[model samples]
Target: MIRRIAATLSALALTLCLGVALWLNDWIDETEIPPLVLETGVEVLDRDGALLRAYTVENGRWRLPVSYDAVDPSFIEMLVAYEDRRFWSHPGIDLRAFARAVWQRLTSGRIVSGGSTLTMQVARLLEDSGTGAWGGKIRQIRLALALERQMTKEEILTLYFHLAPYGGNIEGIRAASLTWFGVEPRRLTAAQSALLVAIPQAPNSRRPDRFAEAAEIARNRVLSRAVTFTDLTEQDVDWARNEPIPTERRDFPALAAHLSDRALADRPTQATHFLTIDVVLQARMEHLARRATTGLGPQISAAIMVMDHQTGEILASVGSPDYTDHPRTGFVDMTQAVRSPGSTLKPLIYGLAFDAGLIHPQTLVADRPISIAGYAPQNFDEVFRGEVTAAEALQASLNIPAVNLLSALGPHRMLSAMGRADMEVSLPMDEAPGLAIALGGLGTRMDDLMRLYGGLARGGIAPPMHWRAGEAPGDGQRILSPVAAWYVADILGDVTPPPNAPRIGLAFKTGTSYGHRDAWAFGFDGRHVVGIWMGRADGASVPGAFGADLSAPLLFEAFSRIGDRPTLRPGPPPGALTLLNADLPDPLRRFDPQGGSNGPPQPSITFPPEGAVLAYQPDLPVIARVAEGTPPFTWLWNGAPIAIGDRDREVILGDIGLGFGELTVIDATGQAGTRQIEIAD
Candidate 1:
């Protein structure tokens, strides 16, 4: 009876134990894996997938995503060899390693190793674990099994590669590689690879920048073990072991900061964005811009943009000399900031005139003092060339010639052309387009200027530039005739290079805005278009900072630094004319500003009617207008010519004598009109 009773109890206990095991198995199978929220920081990469800049996550962690291919093969072998020898063959749990750990701990009276696989570590990271020993280990084991079944080995490795901590705020091999060695993981040497593989085991202890001796010790440990599993020879292992640890972390490459910020702002939720920037070239150009700004004095900054003419890819865009420069307001992106373009827009005006058959490059133009209404435009040097060919006038950037052509072309039409070419020109509120726009009275962004120049480089077809991959190239808009574009490009190419610089053989133009507030240089080779701007963020005038003097040399330097110099001159299209002044047709020789056989209309004063008593203060503003006449009108007070400004429509007659005075206006065609007004004090 006793034997039968023991048998029954044993069976019952065995049955209960089996039932509990089955229940636990079902529970483990049904347990759902916690969702891994690897909220990586925003990363900006160059065209070649090189990191340009990275923003930390809200939690201040650098969790950049990584793929197996992005890491060195040797690093992977060393990692697996040292951490989990059975990683490839095991189904997440290595029975032999666990047994060895238990035996060694029991015999030595202390724990030697945890014996956790990479998959198990990943599972643990996915969970919020407590200090409970056996229970937590069992849970991790179960989760590891589930994960192994759900994910492939490569995926698990990728997770470990990205999630492993390397030091303070740094996670993943990619981040560590960049921070510790100033390079990508794929470019790591044997020493660098071993160092990265050993860091995650004790990240704080092995931080090369913080604990150099500890880091070296850990690196040597990995290197000693690497010879057993990796293809590295004994010599390789010895050299890597002897390699000194990095003493400092490096600054992340800060190329295209403003642009990257803009990209992030546009897609705030995205973790990564790729731009069209060539990081190598971008770095070189940024260095150049910074060096140039130092000599420009305090509070002055510079911006440059490079675009491929054929593909419309913006290869480089340096928004400022230094984005962190607080005194200079370097945070402001001048490339997108609207500022007066000065004489930079002259090339487009001449191109339009050529397309309209209004004039040719060699056409004669008068640069003498003249007025339209009361507005008078002056040259930068305050000296005018009497009779210059259209090409010469444009090459010299004479304000009078540009104003005359703008008056004939009509400001509305010129602005309309710019609009069609995907460039926006900012005008004063409630103001109509005027000839003043021809000489920097309007505002435009540097990007628009690049597009305009890029259009000229692209045989007169203007297309919007592409900044990111997969962006659709816009339809090409015909901004100028092929022949006309070629003519302008040819004229600009012949412009004298800045002193000591080679004739870049590029069609380039420079401009100085009114009050010397902005300097601009836009140039194009056969395959590229480059635009540069230098000025103060507050719009403060920097006297003597003219475009040709301050910005042109930098422009040439940038072109030379651009890798693989392109052909200097572009081939002329059909119907294009390459001729000297004497080879042009008679009608094309001298542009007829009147556009009629009859002489230009006599100038007349429309405001402050003749013989009217006008109340005026010496400092008060007064406007004088003419009913009909050609542009570049000149105003004389008592037969004396005053030094007027660059305008055609209206002139600001500053401080006319308080007594009765005679006002006379003369057009470029030599027609004159006079009026009399008495000022009441």
Candidate 2:
């Protein structure tokens, strides 16, 4: 009878064992291992991956993504030593520590150490819990074993490093390091490492930002015990023990806050978005801009944009001086905001004129008061520099000269040229391109202005600016010939720098919009192009916000910070002449307001006068006649010289095409006139 009972018990035990094995297999298959979705805060890094700015997660936590390799070795060692000494070899649980704890609890009739391994803690965090309840503990033990099978020890450690909370809605060593000590975890000191290791045990009660005494005690515990696992000497532990806990949390780096916010909004799903910004340069310029806006009138703000001249990549883009200052409307991004460009467009006008061989830098031009069809322009100082070289007129920013040059290089054509180079020149509502655009009569963003100046730095090729990695740097469009571009750069480089500032190789220009609503300073050198704007966001005029006074100094100061002194003095381009006034031809000495040369008014097409497009007719003559100026003229069809057949007063073309064409008439005195016409075949 005893034998029969034993056989029955053995059969029952075998059946129970089979059932438990089957249940374990089913649980393993049904359990969906979480993806370890570490939703860290959005981070904007510089070109070299330096942190520029970080935005808090939706839970208001400053959790930054970190890897095992990114942390200090001593911190990891201390963490393992304090939390789970057998983390490297153990599959999930330390049986020896668990047995010791169980024995101590049974003997004392009270709870002792919990004996939780790092992997088990990671499993609990993954399931979003930290309760030490028996049921939760059992579930975490199973999950920890499962996690060990799936992920290596290093990966589980990485999970622990990132998901482990330090204190007060801040997670990960990176965030805690930045918050408590104002440094990166990669450069953590011995004391800083010990503090970080102790925080995760009781993050809230021992938060360094709040409970200083509790934090110091926790830090000392870790330091005293760290020598067992880490390579820290007793001297190191003693030194770290004396280190004071941080009393207050330090603010995270907010170098490019506005840009980082925009990047976050633009790339919503991304946890990390790296920009092309140089964080060091960006911080310096932002500080400078912030300081400059301090003494200015109320509601005033400043913005700056720095670009790589060669690649057209944005190195720094400060949208506003203080992003959180509500009085200044600092939330508004002024770098991409449309505002009047003022006299900054003047240099492009002269550059275009030079490219067309219509004017030289040394060519004489009148800055005297002039009017055309009831529109007259004056100099900025209201005192014209009469009979000055083209370069001098530009340096003085004479409005009359710019208008005259724009008139010669038709406004519509000038706008078209800029458009071809990927620049957007915003015009007034429903208005055609006019000479007033030479002044601040139109709107343009600071970014577009920087790109245009960057083009000048790149020999008149305007390429699109890059702000993100992996973007292709496309070939730019030619806006001006090399000679013309060099000429403009040379003239701008001659401007006097501010007091005590060395002349960097930069060629800069300043512009103040109408009503003083916008102040701009755009500069470029062999390497960088920086543009700045200072004004109120509401378009309200500031009384003393002149571009030269307010923005120019900031521009030069930025150049000084970059340590770019005028090293490469760009020489004159081929086919460009640097002739003196006396060496210039008589006609080029002083511009004739009446015509291209020192002659009478330019001859006009009498029959098909201005704005005339004649239709092609086989029975009628395509007649052309000069209205005024010296006779004995030479006619040109399209752009080539054509025979006049001994006819000085008028000429007749036999045939014409079905498209648009230009007619040119040049007289013996070197004065010329052009008229556009369309002929329907």
Candidate 3:
């Protein structure tokens, strides 16, 4: 009877203990685990994953996310050694450490160490629970066990690396490293690693920026302990102790400021953004822009853009000289602003003419003073070259030959070509397309011109430029035939560089807008295209600021900084003809509006005699008589075509404006004559 009672009591006790243990397990399982998702700031990185800029998180904290792989091995080893020596072997709690802490407290009447494992610390950090209370400690132990079950050791350590505070409003190893050391934590010195390990214990009191001495003391303690626990030797620790701790926080990288702002504004919820810009190139370009604009004027500003024409990737873009300078209105992005293109559009005009088979490079064209419709355009020096080859006229940027070519090609056709190339040009509202468009009487942005030039560089196919990484390139539009494109590049490649500038073998053009409001230089090599602009931000004229003087030198300097010799120019295309004036076809030898016909005598404008001054009247019609050779004629007022296919010898010139005007008549046989007259009020 005694043996039976004993067995039954033992069985009851065992069942009760089993029930209690099951209840404890259930209670632990029901513990509320806070969300493990961490909120971090947005980071803008270059193509190579270099940080270009960073934005603060909510509550104005400089907390960037870090991973186990991004940290240095030394830092991890020291951190594990100093915080939880047996972190790899412990399940959640270290009973040996706990027992030692209790024994020390009983002997000394004071608590020596907390004996909390790294997992327990992570649990407390995750919940933001205080360590002074028994309830919080017990809760941490439970949560630590749960965390160890759910996450790997590396993951828990990464959480600690991210959540551990360094100083005021700064969290994570990345933030601390960038703030104090001005570099990533991927590679750190022994001192830097030790300092990072010491900061979490007393973040506020031992901040190196505020209390360097205190921080050094804490750091030395870790290093001394590291001698035993880590691979660091006494010599390494001694060397690290001699190194100076950073006393002030560093500013995060602010390269590509405008682009960063744009990226952030574009996707506010994104944690990180990757762009195609090269940080090194971007920095160099920004420096170049600042140097170019300094001492010009307080209001003067500059912009630059560099791209790979083949792939249409923007490698570097400097929007303004200084983004913080309010006097220059640096907040504006000039690359996207619509301004006059001036002679920058000349190459395109010449290219189109070549494509239309209207003129060869060696074709003779007249650049004498002439008027079209009512507009009289002149060369930059107000001089005239009576006759010049098409190549010479373009090389000198003479206005008359370009206008003549545009007159033949029609302005609307050129615009259509641009549209086909995916370039948008803005003309004045309610104005008909006219010959003045040939000499930059329209508005276009720098980016659009880069695309156009990039097309020229890529054998006439213009690829759309992009900034975002991994963006698929679109099928480019054909702006010119391969032959015509080659011709343009060949001519531009020989353009003379500015004084004192190296001959970098670049095919480039420079343009100064009317009134010197905007100066532009667009250039390309075998693989790249770069555009530069300099002027006042407010659109005010910069006196004597010519593109050749202001922007051309900067363009060359930019190429030099790009640090690659210009690639070799491509060979001529199959259909491209290389001919001299004497060896050319009759029609291709001279630019003739009458199809190279020589049958009729040259026409003359007889009614408006040379240097004749006529009275100006609003609605008066002046009769123009042509004396000589052909039955049908084309007459131009100013440089604009007024009448075509006129069978009569006399045509009425109606509403001639009050000014010096030119009357030109082209006969059916490709012979022409002109008369300069004045209509005075």
- On TM-score, the candidate that comes out on top is 2
Task: Identify the runs in model 3 with alpha carbons over 4 angstroms from their true place.
Answer: 1-20, 102-111, 564-566, 592-681
lDDT of 2 at 458: 76
Candidate 2 has a TM-score of 0.86
Worst 10 residues of 1 by lDDT: 638-647
Candidate 1 accuracy as TM-score: 0.84
lDDT (Cα, tens digit) per residue for candidate 2, span 298-389? 59999999888777788888998888889999988899788999999888898877654346688788888888878887777789767888
Model 3 residue 443 CA deviation (Å) reads 2.4
| Clash total of candidate 3 | 7
The alpha-carbon RMSD values of the candidates against the true structure, listed in the order shown, are 12.9, 6.3, 11.6
| Winning model by lDDT | 3
Which has the higher TM-score value, candidate number 2 or candidate number 3? 2
* Tens-digit lDDT string for candidate 1 (1-681): 999999999999999999998986786688688875566778899998888889887578777777788888878888898888889999888989889888998899988876788888887767746423878888888888888888889888888887888999898888888889988887678899888888888888888888999988888888888888778899998888777889999876778999999999999888889999999999988999899998667799999999987888899999899999998899999999999999999999998777655567887998989788788989999998899999999999999989988887689868977987899888999998889999989989999988888888877889568888657477668787677788888899899999998875888999999999999999998888889899998899998899999999999999998888776666877556677667754445587565533665655679878898887766577777777866666565543344232246678777766766557665555445566678788
Question: Which one wins by lDDT: 1 or 3?
Answer: 3
Give the distance in Å from residue 452's predicted Cα in candidate 2 to where it truly belongs.
Answer: 1.3
lDDT of each: 0.82, 0.80, 0.86
